[model samples]
Target: MGIVSNRQNASDYDDDMKRAKAAGIDAFALNIGTDAYTDTQLAYAYQSAADNDMKVFISFDFNWWSASQGSEVGAKVAKYANLPAQLMVDGKVFVSSFTGDGVDISAIRSAAGCNVFFAPNFHPGQGDFGDVEAALNWVAWSNDGNNKAPTLAKQLSVSSGDNTYKAALDGKPYIAPVSPWFSTHFGSEVSYSKNWVFPSDLLWYNRWREILQESPRFVEIITWNDYGESHYVGPLSSPHTDDGASKWVMDMPHNGWLDMAKPFIAAYKAGSKFPIEFLDEEKLVYWYRPTPKDVDCDATDTTMQGNPNNSSGNFFRGRPDGADTMADEVFLVTMLKEPATVEVQSGDISVTLEASPGVWSHSVPMGVGAQSFKVTRGGKTVDSLSGTSLRDITDTCPCGIYNFNAYVGTLPAEAAIDQLQPDGLTMLSQGLQVACPTNTLGASSASAT
Candidate 1:
């Protein structure tokens, strides 16, 4: 879902549409709240979608709007229902909401003056709603509940039960939701900010694999740009400067996550083995906290109000210490055309592995100085790049919250490759390599190019 709160221009929507469209997204489920500015920007978004031959629909934010009033939401939805870009499912206008259990959805259908295909995340602790055409679970944090849920088994059961139950009853389609990562340390003060990290360790790949197995009708990437919660898989240029949430991700390149998603989408649609199409080039997408969980970036805000694992509620029950789930290792998702030996070196430590083609990940522990990586084939280096320095305090702002941004760096395409030799090393084009520090760091050194 895309947030409409940012004061965007036609150019902004146009650019975002182009990016998402190229990535195999057909429509945008605009997650809008009750703000006058958002209402205005929504119009521009619809027009831009139409111009770009893309589809747009509403996923109302009842949390910010009047929850009890259905008429208000219907009226707002009706305004864009007739637009050329309005998303329609089997001739009915597609409609959804972030939270709308309190609102009368039947009344909303009547007020819209159109046949609405409504699927919403109306079920919290109250359980699933039978009235909607489909059900959505917006907050499936982790596959293994190691960090987010109580135990690994609970995580597996919860995911299995939620998907199985929703996809079975009524023969209705369950929207299979997949997110790359989750964190809200930037907004820990808010009620929803229980810093949850699903450990991107094979998260996107594994979740897509699960969703494909379930055979759900639709798939929704948790968010394109919910910058505060930090599951954003899109560019982070939009400002959530009000709470200084932008500082957490600022230039941290999460775009590679989106780029990596293209292959997954192709595989999901094809319903076959995911093809590693880009064999001509290689790229590595990696992320990690620069500092360990025990290391506090800010010493003053030690009240520990935002620790997700330590919170007293069911949503926040996991670890009593509320520590981070990630290990002190750089998680690597590499894109390769063929077999190659990849090396992650820092200080005196260097780990090498024989990597095959497709999306494979490996965790390399942090050492010292600036971390660097190299892709060697037949004993010759093909790709190499320097990453962020492993500093004690990587975060710029000494706030109590954690800095979860991953410092990413792509291997330069122009880098020279050694010539083929009889010894067996062959000349290969440089593949991309990206990595982040293990401690708190400001912004990102990652480049999309």
Candidate 2:
């Protein structure tokens, strides 16, 4: 998971670690820039990880550092190499990066004065770094063959990037990335200019299945709290939204996505195929953009062209490349203990599908108004989400700004009965009743539909 450096205290890191641990996450890759609070935040994060029995490693943001700063990067890594929470591999420090392809890895290891397992993202041809022990492929989304300048008109093969990276690794470890969605609305207002959306209908469900099939050495979810890009799978922590991203992220909650990922994560670690066996509770997780794609806004941010820093901007204006590629539909995934009938209602459009016992994904065209969902087994309503529970899809842009961000919701919305404790952590109320009946389904019988 990618953790931004905007935390206030150790407690903030503790809360995130606890939640991540509960989700079966092992470590957090702290993405830090050259901000003044980098050291302070890293200290808090390392301490919290140690307290929570979680591992952590630093991932330098090359946007702030240049190829000449290899020594500075190595010094930072060495400073925390001996920390209790630092992630170590084979008695060597585990180091990674977002983008620092041309940097000298030998200089980094020489400065650190220790063995280093380097796994930096060297996209657009994994550079000639013979010292790289492993490689990290950061292209998590489906796109054209071009990684630097993707053609919006071409549809690339699914998991094509992973295949290429595996071939390039030549039997070495390849860290594959998996992300549910991607859409940013930043412009020249911020130091960078980025605005675009990949075609991500059912991406969250599809990518997990792909991971189970490929079983890469390591799988890093693209982000945990990248609100500006709208792919955050963590809870909405207001304190971490200081990057002017709250405008679109405040009311949007993506905890349901994590809940849906629990079973898949467990199965992946267990070396199992497409998981169908851990359906202890029935869950119906759904996600969709609040506004229709056809809606017009006063400003349209330009689509990103490879590097955000080098791209020109028009303040808050320009149309995204794949805007027209997005389907006007509500994507959903269901985890059931038995065969059931699922129904999705988006405004006046309702679509029903019969799902067998296991995990299933389906989508229905979106409509204007409140959305609702339900699961029925043997002609009885087992689980459901009323229309009043979620925000209604509208024709106008939210707050007059284009928000391609997705709002995810579950059948038994956990937020409805979540209680904030004295320690500033939210927990589900104990012994809460759920609409879906529980069952003891064996993992061997679990299958994906």
For model 1, state the Cα shift of residue 91 in Å: 1.4
Tens digits of lDDT, candidate 2, 1-449: 12344466777788789988998998888887888878998998999999999999998888887878888889989999999999988788989888898888878888888788888887646464466878888788877655322464676755888888787778878898888888776644446556677777788889999999989878898788787778888777523524445445645778888888888888899898756776667778888988898887654322221234435542224445567768888888888777888777789888888877677888889999888876777788874432333567899766455678888888777744222112221111111122111111111231111
Residue-wise C-alpha lDDT for candidate 1, range 1-449, written one tens digit per residue: 22344445666588678989988888888888766677677888898899999999988887687767788888887888999999999799999888677778777888899988888876644534666777676755554434354354454533664655474445787776888766544223334434445555456656766765665678889888776566777665432223334334543556667766777677677775553752334676665554445554443332243443335332432221224555666667777777888787754568887888876777777554456677788887773422433233233332333555454434542132111121111101111011222212332452222
lDDT of 2 at 382: 79
Candidate 2, residue 270: how far the Cα is off, in Å = 0.8
Query: What are the models' TM-scores?
Result: 0.79, 0.86
TM-score of 2: 0.86
Worst lDDT 10-window in candidate 1 = 423-432
lDDT of each: 0.60, 0.72
